[model samples]
Target chain A: MAQVLSLHAAERRQLAAWACDAYPHEACGLMLGVSEADGVRVLEVRRARNLNVERARDRYDIDPADYLAAEREATARGCELVGVWHTHPDHPARPSPTDLALAWPGWSYVIAAVTAAGMTELRAWRLNGGHQFDEESIEEADPS
Target chain B: MSHIVIRIPTPLRGHTAGADEVPVEARSVGEALARLGELHPGILERVLDGDGQPRQFVNIFLGSGNVRALDGMNTPVRDGDVLAIIPAVAGGGHESGGCKTESPSGTDYRA
Candidate 1:
């Protein structure tokens, strides 16, 4: 009985494209959306600048100013800064040990996997009550 | 005693009596954090570990730059400066999954 994350197909492509473009370095962004009992609806994707130059391949550190700005923007737009998304070059779209160690609860975490063959997978996860990651289903809506 | 503002991120707001920004007067970052802990109990423990060193996951920013990049806790503070405490964030796998739990470090996320 895993939770679900609903995003538009276009937004999915956007995330994949951004991750692909940031190959060899991780790209991160904020998700602006609404959360409900049934699922989370992603309304927009706010691209953030990754400042962690030393570990761009597997790690990302979003600028604090950018994070604040995104939060403010989401508040003004009647949405919440739901969660963060980062790319993992040559890695599977799963929560790494560092990711779990640094994770906060209550926000969505969408991870994009980009490989030499290009963007291969995009999945989402949530920290379950056991303080471990549990995969959630992604429901992509058709583009209008 | 120079008056400075400390911006508390949402996750740490509960420790500050639900205050987003706390105004305190101190000469250095260490003094400010100390005064902040005095004003609100159980806060310094969240920012600093038992050895009085800032936790590895916590990032403190003076204005737009990280204090760690400048001078660690010894970074001097002045009037009108803003210090922000932002802990490392992770663990959302779903866009709307209600994983409203504390971080793996066992830090309380009651809010």
Candidate 2:
């Protein structure tokens, strides 16, 4: 059976806004409180430098210290870092090669693509051990 | 011409009228994207900059590899090549202190 991973409508809107806000430069951040029973919950969002200065692409580092702190906080809250997300400017929201190599097995990778027309496209994926991508769908609900 | 698949995200599905994936053909990534633009009309600006280069936050993958390490949008694709686009996700708590020491580059956390 295929497992479905999704984001709340409010969270989806927030992520879309972030993707557009961090335009031109790739935005990097993490998702917190991912639970199988509760589904994926998006927590904090952070924007980081691409670090790939030469190519000006979307490479990221979560400030090792900050990353550890996030892990500890999640553990304390009995949550898991179940998913990771990023932005794609002017491209469809999908997983890239670096995304595949960087993605950890069992984690959901989310990508948000921002368009020149000021639109945001969000998609999710899972990386197989063979480094192949399995596309996941996002079911959106009316934002109340 | 080989067909390349462009996967659409939910948020942007309105642009494709909720179509999850669209197929296009071109010799290079740019041409393929141009084909995508022809079908989608105004999506190119969203994925590319005024200079015709991919935006900084967006990452393009040709098959299982990142185009950045390759020739970027110029990377060649044959029939059945799957191109995946990934955007950046940000947001998290910052460390107050103690954990501020920078580690050497290239350290794998899981190793």
Candidate 3:
């Protein structure tokens, strides 16, 4: 069965906000959550500084130190660092070949597309049995 | 040999049988990684390449500091110290601005 990405509506707004705030440049972040039986349930979304200044418009390099800090934060919350996310300024929210080449098999990869009008779409992907990305379903978390 | 704590990143956790932290005994980072590979079948190659160097995408950290800034994999480990594996998160579009980026080989989503 395909894996799903479960996220809260408010968190989805946070993704949009980050993407829009970054505007012309790419915005990057990490998602922390528990790996559920069917998919991932993201509990937090933390900003990751994009260290690629030369090609800020289309490129993103998440700060490794930020990842370490986020991992420790996730651990403290009994969650794990489950995924990496970034914005595609005006590009489509799909995994580019470079994205696929760097991606690992189990973690979710979320891509949000932001334009002058703001975030237009958000998508999730995961490596499949073929070692290639197959779009994963996004399940809106139930408000409790 | 030092008894140390090695924190597994989310992506590599599968190779560690879902164990977030593995207790390993070794005197140096290299030995600790070797022990990890022995206990977890697929992790060594994923973390390190044929040159015995960390794969381009993987980073090994001692506490909050990156090992690359330390002594590479030869960095010595002390008992009760902590290590972490963090894969680089990097990807960009065509530097050409007019063309999609060329990887060694893969579909150019922009095309």
Candidate 4:
């Protein structure tokens, strides 16, 4: 069985909020920091434009310059580009087949689902070496 | 007429008024989209190119595989077939920021 990495509650809530803001178009962003025995911690959240020319599709492209800058920033912070987060405006908060095919093995994929009432739900998954998905849970983090 | 299922994502739901999915029928993917445009005007421009091909950033998946690897917009769908429109993923840092951060375990590292 593959062990899915967990995320902090605050991090999940923040992501959900952002996803809602970018509703309709798939929201794109980066997850910062490393996963520890405790859970996945986020340092910051940055929003990027959905460069997919197909307005209603799942395909997205971050500007090359923006992509490079993000990579540099992540390295400087001593964190790996842990995962990519996006939203499924009116769909369930689950990874679609296209998502599975494009996902790189051994990385986390976060998805946020928004309902008509503007409610948000978030979930995380890990794509294993064999291209299988395992769901991870998000728990609230205690304020220190 | 052959019935085809077109899956709509949230961003484009405005064209379909928040409906998660719509059904249309045509001989080819392009034709199906044309029918969709008739039913929901202005949607074709968002999903197709001037020459009528799928926009570069848009990916049309037939079943579980991408149509680009198959036949582009010429990919045909049978009755009840589901076509998923997906956009390419964008935005991420390449170098400099490593996946290591301060944690209780001294330093957690990821890459």
Candidate whose DockQ is highest: 3
What does candidate 2's lDDT look like per residue over B1-111, in tens digits?
778887543333446775646799888887887888899976666566667776654556676577778997788889988665544332211112222221111122221
- Ranking by TM-score, best first? 3, 1, 4, 2
TM-score of chain B of each: 0.80, 0.76, 0.81, 0.76
- Residue B7, candidate 2: C-alpha displacement in angstroms: 36
Candidate 1 error regions (>4 Å): A1-8, A33-43, A51-55, A63-80, A139-144, B1-4, B13-27, B38-40, B74-80, B89-111
Candidate 3: which stretches are off by over 4 Å?
Answer: B93-111
- Model 4: reference contacts kept, as a fraction: 0.09
> TM-score of model 3 relative to the true fold?
0.91
Global CA lDDT of candidate 1, please? 0.76
Candidate 1 per-residue lDDT, tens place, B36-103, comes to 99999988877887777677667788877888789878899999998888766532222223234444
TM-score of 2: 0.50
Each model's total of backbone clashes: 8, 28, 0, 27
Name the top lDDT candidate.
3
| B-chain TM-score of model 3 | 0.81
Instruction: Name the 10 consecutive residues with the lowest summed lDDT in model 3 chain B.
Output: B102-111
Off by over 4 Å in 2: A37-56, A141-144, B1-111
Task: Give the top-scoring candidate (TM-score).
Answer: 3
Q: Any residue pairs clashing in model 1, and if so which?
A: A103-B90, A104-B90, A109-B92, A109-B93, A124-B93, A125-B93, A125-B94, A126-B93
Candidates' chain A TM-scores: 0.95, 0.79, 0.97, 0.82
**Predicted candidate 2 versus true structure: per-residue lDDT over A47-100, tens digit per residue:** 434444433444454433344344445557756555777777776776654554
Between prediction 1 and prediction 2, which has the larger DockQ? 1
